[model samples]
Target: MALVNTKEMFKKAYEGGYAIGAFNVNNMEIIQGITEAAGELKAPVILQVSKGARAYANPTYLVKLVEAAVAQNPDIPITLHLDHGPSYEMCKACIDDGFTSVMFDGSSKPFEENVAEAAKVVEYAHKYNVTVEAELGTLGGVEDEVSVEADKAMYTDPEQVQDFVNQTGVDSLAIAIGTSHGAYKFKPGQDPKLRLDILEEVSKRLPGFPIVLHGASSVPQEFVNIINQYGGNMPNAIGIPESELRKAAKMAVCKINVDSDIRLAMTASIRKYFAEHPDHFDPRQYLAPARQAVKDMVAHKITEVMGCDGKA
Candidate 1:
């Protein structure tokens, strides 16, 4: 099977009460890990590229890598998406470059400007049969090229959701429900809660329309402990609880963004490998185990959290 757009996938997920995992891809191992796990579980997946990831790994290489994954796993559905595209031009460029889905992240812009730019990108993307995702509110924390201070982050105003959707015609709406970017989503002893009231209101207004959640990774404590024990410092790193995400999946949220968890898993494995074997200088010697760790993490998320393990 070839790469697919999210239109049909989102429709199915909306009716099925589950959300597809949108994992950010950086290199070959990360892509391999995510796709392998999703394929094994027969789950539909989205391999998304962030601006930083595009800068790190060339855009063409990432797109071809996703194509290769599709060739390897012909049964599971996969969508290549641009995560948080900053400008109309960037979104258009990705659409032209064969991304089946693109996100125009104008959340930080003025409301009217954001709607106008998103609408522009939507118009362009629709012409190419590419789905567009637009963010309604800013999510805080640093990951890739997306960074917003906590003071600047705001919960998506439920009142504006309908207008935003009607004006932009975005294929999916990413709303800020208290989840932030990166592993440190919440501070120690702070309650990590999603604004389900806001989610409820958005669902009431948008009914069957697909919704998206950014910064949805539940950072596994095992990885954090392993990294810290093996000469790494990721102190007080936290993430959304899996239970909350499961509830969100049952709502209109048909797509969930995850990146930091994969990073944590790979980093922990590599750290442990290096600490145990000081003589292994070859990249494969360490990267192989790191890739396996990522695969395991993704499999766990699909089966336990997202509940899309066999929905492919």
Candidate 2:
């Protein structure tokens, strides 16, 4: 099947009480791993590219990689998306380059500025049959180029959701409800809590409109342990609990972004392989296991947190 926009995917997820996994992709192995897992699980998946990712892997290469994935996994639905597009030009570039969906993250801008810019992107994106996602409120932590201090993080105002959606004409809304942007979402002794109350209120206002959650990866302890054991020093790297993500899925959240988990899994596997076999120098030797780790992590997410295992 050809790549599709999030419109139909989100609709089905909303009605079926599940959320599609939006995994960030920056390389061939990561793309292959995520698509392979989604294909096996018969789940719809969204492969996203951030600005930093575009810089790391050229836009043309990223698009071609995703296209190859679609060709390889013809049975499952896949969407190519631009995650946290900083400007209309960026969103337009991705849409023109064959992205099925684009997210204009103007949350850091003033409310009016955000609405205007997002609306402009929506106008351009819809003309090309590409769906747009907009964010309201700010998330804490760092993901690629996105970074906000915890003190600056703010919960989305439920009342503003209706206006943003109406004015922007975005296909989905990503709201900040306590889920931060990166691996260190919380402190060592602090408890991680999502304001489901904010989600509830936003749902009531928008009714059936699709909602999205950024930084939704539940950083698996096993992967963290593996990385630490193999000469990595990531301390207190926590994430949203799976139970909370499942709860969000049962509500209006139709799309959840997961990036750190994939990175950790791949890094851990590569570190372990190199540590145990220092004699190997072939790139494929280490990448093979890293790819497998990505596949395993994505499969676990599909069946566990996303609840999108068999919903294709």
Candidate 3:
């Protein structure tokens, strides 16, 4: 009924061998679409807000939008999470602003510094019963304000996972295993692959600990084709394969962050709608189907990819 943290969701997912879909939300329609799907599927979901999202849609507006979603879907468990909170201050602000969970992404920093900063966030967040998530590896590509060059992207060092988890006391840990941040995850001719071997080693070290995958969105080719068919020119835009993500879900991955696929779905729908109705001027005309597109995409994820359907 109320906003719950990822603690219970991750626990159940770990035991059930499925992963919860963590959808990034920017507005009322997106929230409606994601939560509506969750309600129908009987799945626990996470609604995450990134730094850019807060900047675009005012933090208070996003929080109230999630509150409205909670009111609408009282039967489904939901978590309002701050994604990639870059600093202790940001994490503190989200915890103070009633976020059920917050991520302190200090992966780019030195290992010791990351642990120390994450520990500070965990200490502060736990005071308010808020759960904390931390990142260990630098992911390639860009999402919101976070970016890493492909050459610089690094897989999480399995050797340091135990030490980092022990030091930070984070509720969940996001590790990079070839999944990048944005839509252009792989080149046109390149084979997209995830380093599942690294994940296996991490699991061996941190048994039963909740693991998370950022940039897990499978850029649905149908959406890409629709967008390209209309007016968009996103060339060779690809993403992590759903098969790989599903495999990770059954592993130690308890949470999978999906952002770009939702964007693509909504954008493709709006583009196609306008292409068909050039005379339309109302935002609702296009946004309605865009909302439905989000719902459809999320449903596929819940039932097909994450396998979290009926796990609420």
Q: Rate the local accuracy (lDDT) of all candidates.
A: 0.92, 0.94, 0.93
- Tens digit of lDDT per residue, candidate 2, span 203-235? 999999999999988787888898898888888
Give the TM-scores of the predictions, in the order they appear.
0.98, 0.99, 0.99
lDDT of 3 by residue, 146-235 (tens): 989999999999999999999889999999998999888887777788899999999999999999999888777788899999978887
lDDT of 1 at 304: 80
**Which residue pairs overlap in candidate 1's backbone?**
none
* Residue pairs in collision within model 3: none
lDDT of 1 by residue, 152-245 (tens): 9999999999999999999999999989899887877888999998999999999999999999988788988999898878887678998999
Name the runs in model 3 displaced over 4 angstroms.
none
State how far residue 153 of model 1 sits from its true place (Å).
1.0
Residue 288 in candidate 1, Cα distance off native in Å: 1.0
Query: Which parts of model 2 are misplaced by more than 4 Å?
Result: none
Decoy 2 TM-score against native: 0.99
TM-score of 1: 0.98
Which lDDT value does model 2 have at 52? 97
